[model samples]
Target: MPDDFAPTPTTLTTADGLSLEAQWAVPLKHRAKVVVAHPHPQHGGNMHSLVVSTLFAHLIGSDCAVLRFNFRGVGRSEGEHDFGEGEQLDVRAAVDSLAQSGDAQCPLVLAGWSFGADLALTCDAPELAGWFLVAPPLRVLGDERFKAAPDPRPKWLAIPERDQFNPPDQAQVAIADWTNAEIHPISGADHFLVGRTDKLNALIDSFLSAL
Candidate 1:
């Protein structure tokens, strides 16, 4: 399916009563379901971040039900940003919204980019089938979560070869203890993935296709 697969705009209510703005598309077959988290709201990150947008557009018409949303305090979402802490509830709200759609039992995948990646890792959800983290800045975020209670679920780390924060070599070292993790280095790309979205989509598609 193409990127313009027509999304339905909606609102998600978090456990804490905050409402988040969201968009989603569900496939007929529903082979997989995915909840995509945007980058840091402190920056220009939102559900519209290129990486999150690209993933939403690419996965929409496929067998995956995709949901992307703005965190609290971003765009039309309610409440102020609690940094990454409250954002975790936003992620869970997205997952809950996706689950309310067709085939709630479908294998769910949690995918995030940059700051969103950190939130995905920190979110206290164990029902996810796997995780796809793109250009995560591991140097500054939750490293103990993976170390203290390393999840065995498959995790795909799509790192930019020249990432400004987490380079491929450093990423390898950081995720070494993540027993089921695999790193795929995107050639000639940066942390933002400015002009290499096709490559990023391919890497993510390949990872999900394998499962």
Candidate 2:
């Protein structure tokens, strides 16, 4: 039903009165949804970043509603960046906003690229059906100080062939605890999947399709 969908711009205020700017490329007929998180806000990441936007654009015509939002201090969202702390709260707020759109049992997916992926794992909303993390900083999220990943989750980690942020050897050890987590390497792609979008899109599509 979503063969030719166009995303609609949206904004929602969280319980804390912070205004979040978002983009929703909802399916033409389906009501299920997915919320995407952006990269680290402190490093110039926002909802419009190339990788995040690509993820949003890749799923525009999918069966699930796709949501992408800017965190506090990033883009139109108010306040300064909290590194990962406030951003995690922002991600949960986005999840709650999407949950309120339909039945409580509606299927929901959470995806983040880079540091955003780490934030996605911070959201433990019981309503989420799955998670898709692209080029995540596994060590950063693994630190007990940041917080543990969502419980017993179904996750997909798309790592670039040569991501300098999280070394390949380190990633292998970091992903060991995730029972449903699977990691795939994109050949010749940088940490951001630079000039290899077609492969990135194909990988993302296959993951969602499997669900």
Q: Quick one: best TM-score, which candidate?
A: 1
In terms of lDDT, which candidate is strongest? 1
Query: TM-score of each candidate?
Result: 0.92, 0.88
Candidate 1 C-alpha lDDT tens digits along 1-211: 5344467898999999998999888756677888998888888899998999998888885667889999999999999988677777888888777777878678788889998888788754756778888988864355764421277778899999899999999989887767788989999999999898899788877877887
Query: Mind giving the per-residue lDDT tens digits that candidate 2 earns over 1-53?
Result: 34435677888676667888887765545545778888877778889888888
Worst lDDT 10-window in candidate 1: 140-149
Off by over 4 Å in 1: 1-5, 145-149
